[model samples]
Target chain A: MKTLSYFLILAFSGGEHAGGGSPLDVNPGLILWTVVTFIFLLLILKKLAWKPILKSLNDRENLIKESLEKAEVARKEAEKLIAENKLNMQKSEEEAQKIIEQSRELAEKLKMQILEDSKKTANKMLEDAKAEIERKNAEAFNKLKEQVADIAITAAEKILKENLDKAKQINIVDKYLNEINKN
Target chain B: MYTGQELIGADTLKQVAETAKKTDTSWIMHDVLDANEIDLTPFGIIHLPHLNLFGFDISITKHVVFMWIAMLILIFVLKKVAKSYKSSLIPKGVTNLTETLILFVRDEIAKPTIGKGYENFLPYLLTVFFFILTCNFLGLIPYGSTATGNISVTATLATLSFLVIQIGGIWKNGFFGYFKGLLPHGIPAWLIPIMFVVELLGLFTKPFALAIRLFANMTAGHIVILALIGLIFILHTYVVVPISIAFALFIFLLEILVALIQAYIFTMLSSLFIGMAVHQEH
Candidate 1:
């Protein structure tokens, strides 16, 4: 066997072409060993290496799915918040508008009330001034009528004194008055 | 399109030599070995360029080394991740990342399709996604082999998905009920046999489609990037630095997207199949 191995080694080691060796010609034993080792390793990997590894991967996938679901819920909540904010804003705007209208109505009512009171007060003052002026004019007219009557009586007395004596003059005046009445 | 060394150019030889020297092979057959000078037209591995092995010819090459390395990485990464889950709720760091993906597959992919009480199928779905993604991403690495790029690998994965769908379906419904679920409710009696044949054929066809879809998608991206890289080589023939830089950046971005997309598509299709199997009506 040693001689055969030496011969085999000698044949292979000869100085020959550089690029001409077939794979089948070298290391048949090594090839067999390699195949067997590969199969064995495959079995061991399946048992010891792959099982635990798969579990971890499954865990990670589950984690990702859970996180995605949480993100979706958060997004929905944010949308609801935005919607609520818009609703509140609209409600406040409507309330503010209503308050402004009510204030304007109150202001208009106050202005109308002030105008009505001033007109009533002016009417009362005008009536009082007219009554005072009318009373003053009536008093002046009475005084002028009294002065005219005094002047007419004085003229009549002067005419009678020149015509007759005092007692006879009275009788003559009465007869003249009676004659004037008959005529 | 070319699987091995037939597509190798002169510069690819130099790269292979540099890589081989870096691997620290203390045993040397010859004192002076300029790999660039060696003629490689005779070997079938030439279809895959820029690939070489330590001390072999016309067989497995650096791409195979990358494949092996990817397998080792898958084992080591899975082991470390599994070990981290000893005490706590779940593992942290790389374990945590893997664990999240597993859960995504269980909850998003398997649960929706497989219906209630689908947690039991998480193991199988997680296994399929990680295993396929690992293999698919392996090809995105520089000088890395995409095991899923091979039709065989995709076919195997698709077959497993098919098996699971059937098994799960059978488990959910009884043996007879499972088959009966295939036919729609309104089919006339005369068309039942024909529909059964078509449905049976479709059952196989679904996995076949899965295999082709994954294999084509994974392989197409790599080939496009390889071709783009090849453009620089063809253009300058010698100035590979700038071209490599540009192509690497473009391919890196594209590969990252491709890696995620491939993982998603595999998981989606698998889930769809499982869903169809379990709940045939909806």
Candidate 2:
């Protein structure tokens, strides 16, 4: 390797003095130096600069991509939650409507039941009042008939006492009683 | 186009050197384009120290130093941004800017061109984009030279891309399959050799254009700016300074845009070539 580089240097520097007339001359030495310098620069830079920079750039790109994917998932989840909420709200509203209808039916039935109960109670009260009035009228008519019977008996007894003697009265009364009986 | 005095000065020095060589004059100096003299080297506006290592002239030129500065700047800024990246998921400030650029290269350039295999080449594309951009921007600085403007440097980068393209092909399709895949299925056997040559040339021409396009574009911008500044020097008058400075500033701002554009073009073309090599459907 050393000998090869030495030969390369000699060969490159050999034509240095050939073109002295113009400044457009070629210098093999400068060529050798430039080649060495450029190669050295390339190697060092590849190791130190390009490797890490490219890696970081790629890393940042991947990070952004992953974040975007995560955001999409989150947005989808939010949409699903919103849809579920809407569905739940609809179900609750339906339940509330059903409850209102049931209560209205129940109220109508309750009003009818109350009206029937009041009519039955009013009929029973009217029948009880008519029975009491009929019983009081029958009791008054019996009492008046008993009093007229007593007065008629008293008047007949007084008339018999005033008109005739004892025996004759008895015979006359018998005759009269017989005549009264025949009449 | 009025040439600059620096070129005229070099020409005179060259003439002086040739004359001295022929006549052995006593008063002739040792170095004509010496450090003390004005530098007219095509590679750099200011001459720098020449370094030699292991029988090779590894000179510390202005472009090399500026390339190092650009590299250091890239390392420091990227490291800081990388540290910030570790702590936070979101980017801010310089981290935000750098991340935007990196992501643009990945999504717009690497991903669209390379497709499924973009990850494998992202680091390399990023490196080329940043390195070339830094080098291009360095040129717009007052005294900083553009290393990408140099042919050797641009050639080296292009060669790297070419190597990646071929290697990616070979790795995707085995050695034999890769060579076989180059020729179309319906071609006559007599035309196979000609087709092979054409395809191979096509392979080379792509990277060649890459290197030349970057080098020429970067070099041309600087030359225009220098030429604009040279106008002031050629006229040798203070009256021309405002106009020259204004034009130079306008081109300098334009250079900033061109610098970014050329870097993007280089990386985009590289990714396209690699994509074609690895997937070779048509």
Candidate 3:
């Protein structure tokens, strides 16, 4: 089994130095070159590639963060504006309601004033008509009184001329007038 | 130092020498390293003249060349993305895709693991992730070698991670405090030494695993594919061709997933280690 294993190891390992020599053999020159090459690569890449790439990555990250923050701020501002607009709308609605109320009150007061003025005018007209009728009746009665007195005078003059003396006629007329006034 | 063909040729020469010696014929023998059936040496595909400096073998290998190509590709693509990123705030095309990867490393890996001090180590994590990913993917392409498959390369990366973890800890907590924090408080004095050793070993084991895991995973896929192809040559049969090719293709697809996963694992672990080191409270 040990011999077979050794044979297998040898066969699989490329039949005695197939891929290269003993894999353990270290070449000094290669080592030096690798070190120099790697260091050179490190220095060059550090200066040229990595710095810019890292910076750009960081910059992009910051930019994204800033933009997100700005968006958040803008959203807040919009919300505030909407709230303010809603408040203003409510305030305007209230003002419209108040104006409507005021106008309604004014209309009611005006209607009342007009009714009172018309009532006053109607009452004054009624009183004036009553006074005018009274004055007309009094004038008519005065005229009739004058007329009756004049007629009586005329009749007495006629009768006296026909059959009665002048002094008796004057006394009789006075008594008659007094009796008529008393009746 | 031995190329694959040279190694194979030496094997042939050795066989010839052995036969000749047995047959009582004159033959030349040269000392050579045992030739592996699959010579995995990262050399000899394209002859690059060796240049030495300070006693170090700096001869560029196939893996090194591929690594350079991967680096150039990464640089070009990332630079273009950087330009677009700089010019316009909105990411487009390649920039968009690359940004997703970058952000993943930062947010998922670095931030979650490293916490507050994630920023300091992010670049290193990003570099390691992209570099390893690029290297792993490049290997899948025809004629491309995986630099990450090399132990030396992975070891170097692991060492870097280890260094960062240590340095970050020391920097965050003073030197004495950092080492002191390794041992849990309220432990018995006798047991403290054992716990300290265990903790010290734990520190090394983490990076060691990082290196071995990446190196093995990356190399294993390539070996499987190579072995599958090698079956055709070994059997010398047309029947094996379709089977080998089909299996290789399957493994190749799986490798793409492994490539990304390994890169992620490396980066994630590195960050975790650094996070642990810097913030010892947790």
Name the best candidate (by lDDT).
3
**How displaced is residue A168 in candidate 2, in Å?**
29
Residue-pair clashes per candidate, as listed? 21, 1, 3
What are the runs in model 1 whose C-alpha is more than 4 Å off? A1-41, A52-183, B1-71, B83-92, B236-248
In candidate 2, which residue pairs get closer than 3 Å at backbone N, Cα or C atoms, i.e. clash?
Answer: A23-B42
Error of 2 at A125 (Å): 6.2
**What is every candidate's C-alpha DockQ against the true complex, given to 2 decimals?**
0.05, 0.21, 0.21
Chain B TM-scores, listed for every candidate in order, come to 0.71, 0.81, 0.83
**Tens digits of per-residue lDDT for model 1, B38-79:** 223355333433423454232333334444566566657766
- Poorly placed runs, candidate 2 (over 4 Å): A1-23, A104-183, B1-49, B229-247
Local accuracy of candidate 3 as per-residue lDDT tens digits, B25-108: 110000011111112336443455565789998667666777788889988899898888667878889988899999999999
lDDT tens digits, residues A1-183, model 2?
443454444333432332232234567788888888999999999998999889988998899999999999999999999999999999999999999989988899888888888887888777877877788778777765665555445445644655666776677656656654573
- Return the interface RMSD of model 3: 8.9
Rank candidates by DockQ, best first. 3, 2, 1
Residue B261 C-alpha lDDT in model 3: 99
Residue B93 alpha-carbon offset, candidate 3, angstroms: 2.1
Model 1 alpha-carbon miss at residue A150, Å: 98
Q: What is the C-alpha RMSD of each candidate to the true structure, in Å?
A: 13.5, 11.9, 9.7
